[model samples]
Target: MPIAEVFLGAFLQVLFDRLASHELLKLAQHKGIDALLKNWEKKLTSIDQVLIDAEDRQLTGDRGVKLWLEDLRNLVYDMEDLLDELVTESAKNKSEAEPSKVPFLLPSCCFNLSSRAFMFDRKMRSKMEEMDNRLKDIITRKDIMRLTEYNGQRSAYRPQNLPFPTTHLTEELFIGRENKKMEILELLTGEEDDGTYMDIKKIPIVGMPGLGKTALAQQVFNDDRVANYFDVKAWACVSDDFDVFSITRSILETTNPQLARECKTLNSLQDELTKNLSGKKFLVVLDDLWDKNYENWIFLLKPFRSGVKGSKIIVTTRDREVASMVDAQLITLEVLTLDYCMELFAFHALGVRNFNHHPNLEVLGRKIVEKCKGLPLAVKALAGLLRTTNNPREWEDILNSKIWDIPEDRINVLPALKLSYLHLPSHLKRCFAYCAIFPKDYEIQRDELICWWIAEGLVEAKEAKNQWNAGLNYFNDLVQLILTWGSLRVITVIYL
Candidate 1:
């Protein structure tokens, strides 16, 4: 999701509240632009109805929707500034004069003035109408855009390929998880209790997105112990919309590129793959499997069945269903503890496992890791963001920033993380977005958070008596959905 999209829904909620306020509308009427304000409110409501859909499609890399969102964003910002100016002017007028029952939002001195001021009013109306026209254009183009996600965009921004999917090891680059690596090694190298084996077994490493499922797989796969155990090993990234032929070709390319090149169809590729793995103890790591189509999964397994008994395939995925569909014993990767995450953070950010000498940053660094909620990809990306800057305040700024507010190019772990956010109910999106205003280290009380949610209009107050309980229920739903790494690390995050 675009950073600007983060606040759109919530900001619109507040904007509507202000626009409907009698005092603000009186000011607009005083300026003789009340109709323009009303029109804008209506048009923005229309856009808000489809804002979630537009954001969903924007992730699909739709050029028109992207442009439309950019236009909406710029227009929203300008409109907000204009509203702020009006409010400030109205406040000044109120403070200068006595409060009367007249209900005038701004005094006559603001609008009832000389010809030069009347000319200024006319120009302001023209500008307001022009902005409304732009909003109208956005609506027109939105209809044309049919803003929705495409099939391919599921994997468009996801990191699917292994950095070094070969015999060469990147274990040093992977921090911590030695115990996990050992457990997987035992599974990979150990035999059945009956001292027998099937043709091959699937070792599914399942976890939520941004948890470093691939990195863990890489750590285990590239270990010297496993490298010396299997006769054949290949790593293929099977992201969304997994195609049998494409995956087969990728698997074969690591084994025999020339023969893989010769294969042009699913049949040819699988047959070649079968030959490549036949009668051999093979280890194939299918990294980032997103497809849950059991038929396709079973079909893709045809060649693997030809491998020698005790051969194994390690599968890394964010979905448990995909892991279950593989009919394998799955290993759930737990969230790294704060200690492990700090080390991982420092490693990626400073190319070492500890902060050692950066005393000014060590505390901020831990808070940054806590804000990351111990998700490795987010931790690494955010740490990488600080790798170039030593300023402690810069670290603080990033910590203080909302997940979406950070520039995409600087650190982008949110694409995968946003999937969890998208699954949220419409009301919860605003609830979650508004929570970004809280300080990262603030220890929140349930009652306080509930009050804020109700005040922000993110959730219906229902009857005032039940509003607190309603907010409490919504907060609980968020807790169940949130990626909480440690029991004590409870915090509302835009990163999901």
Candidate 2:
């Protein structure tokens, strides 16, 4: 029972409650429907506290409580379905009876219609009573469980007195990226390959979000060997939106600031790029690319072909598909090792490479570092959170807390990770959110997951020959986006 499930239950309750107030429902109120509606509303009104408490308990790994919460969630879903069915039936009846404009003009037919309405009312009343009994039973079980609301005070993980810095770290502060730096440098400065038609060689640095891809690129970009090898250099942050002209303009400005100030048209921009890069070995770094359109990549790289044979373009992206589309030699980044992770975490948290001054906190710090799973960004983020705190209890609390449970606005690292989730389309969002039901590090079967998505009505109903194919396409899109990692042959896995 994730917090997401609780929020979803609350949302469904609100929707069904609104549906309970329709005109047809009002017309049937006197047939014992009004009392059932009142009882349902009364039971649902106080569920917010119950959901919050369940969420808190789930976060703390209260298995027994989560089982109970799951039961409540299923009941809520059943109630929502029943309410929706009632509304649909009521609408259908209203629509089907609309042609009879003058009931008094046909007395015998009116009497027959009244009799049918009475029968319909009796059936609905019986259904309502059955639903009411089911709800009452659930309520009694809830009371016996004594699931109380969360009464503990909430506090920010980061210290209130010390404001966290929002800027990127200097090279001196970056740790455990030396091997990656050397590899990228070798690729950038290596000898040009022979018999290649493309003048500009492309090298892509690919990894998950916040794995320090940009930092590694920046280190290589500013290195003396790289700077000396290329005559011209430019860097651009090509985030989700990949506008060709904007990127071209940015390249021009970085290469020659004076030319960019005067160039106004695409033709002029291309001319300037040619003039500056022609016959010169150059390096261009494109950071955070999300676009995978091969045509767009070709268009963006068109002007760079005029540069010398050794000229190279370095791309940093989370999506392997983007890397593939760019047709670059790939330099994939892996997570840091435990030792390096600890070094990085300690540097930021206690201003040292080791916890020598605070040896007593070392054990707690190690536990927190384990939670980071060797991801540099996670390590850095947790370090930032603990920088202002000297309490062992605070560190322990973070060690035990689930990352998703943390408030997004407070944790800088989470928003970076969440951006990938937020950018997904509505259909993909539902599919991805549904994965929260699985435990961490669980190997998810692609076919089983798709089946579940279809069953949940998350997949859109189209006139496709196979609906599972549509669901598979949705899963592939998520994989292409690097939100989940696996292969078609094996299994799909989500880190969170």
The residue-by-residue lDDT of candidate 1 on 1-496, one tens digit each, is 2345544654566567667777778777665567778888987777877766676555555567777888887887777666766667567566443333331323445544455444544555566667778888988887787644222111111111223223223535666577778889999998532322445788999998677777788787778888888888888766665767877998899889999999878899988888888777878888778888898888888888777766888998889998899887889987878988998888866777898878788999998788776787667656655665677766765565333444466433463255435434456656767666665434478788888888755565557768777787777756543422111122333433
- The residue-level lDDT of candidate 1 at 490 comes to 26
Error of 1 at 88 (Å): 44
List TM-score per model, in order.
Answer: 0.52, 0.52
lDDT (0 to 1) per candidate? 0.67, 0.65
Error of 1 at 47 (Å): 23
Residue pairs in collision within model 2 = none
Off by over 4 Å in 1: 1-171, 192-198, 404-496
Residue 487 lDDT (model 2): 17
For model 2, how does the per-residue alpha-carbon lDDT over 1-496 read when each residue is reduced to its tens digit?
A: 3434423432443334454555536644523355556667778655544554555555446676667667666667766666666666666666445333332223344433556654654565566667677777767766776766533322222212322221122244667778778887887777763433355678889998658787787788878898788888888877767878778988998778898888888889988897887777888988888898888888888888877767888899999999998786789988888888888878878889988889988999887777667777667656755776678876765665444455544443343233233223446655666776775435589899998877765666544446688898777765543312111111122222
The local lDDT score (0 to 100) that residue 323 gets in candidate 2 is: 92
Alpha-carbon runs more than 4 Å astray in model 2: 1-170, 192-198, 258-265, 402-496
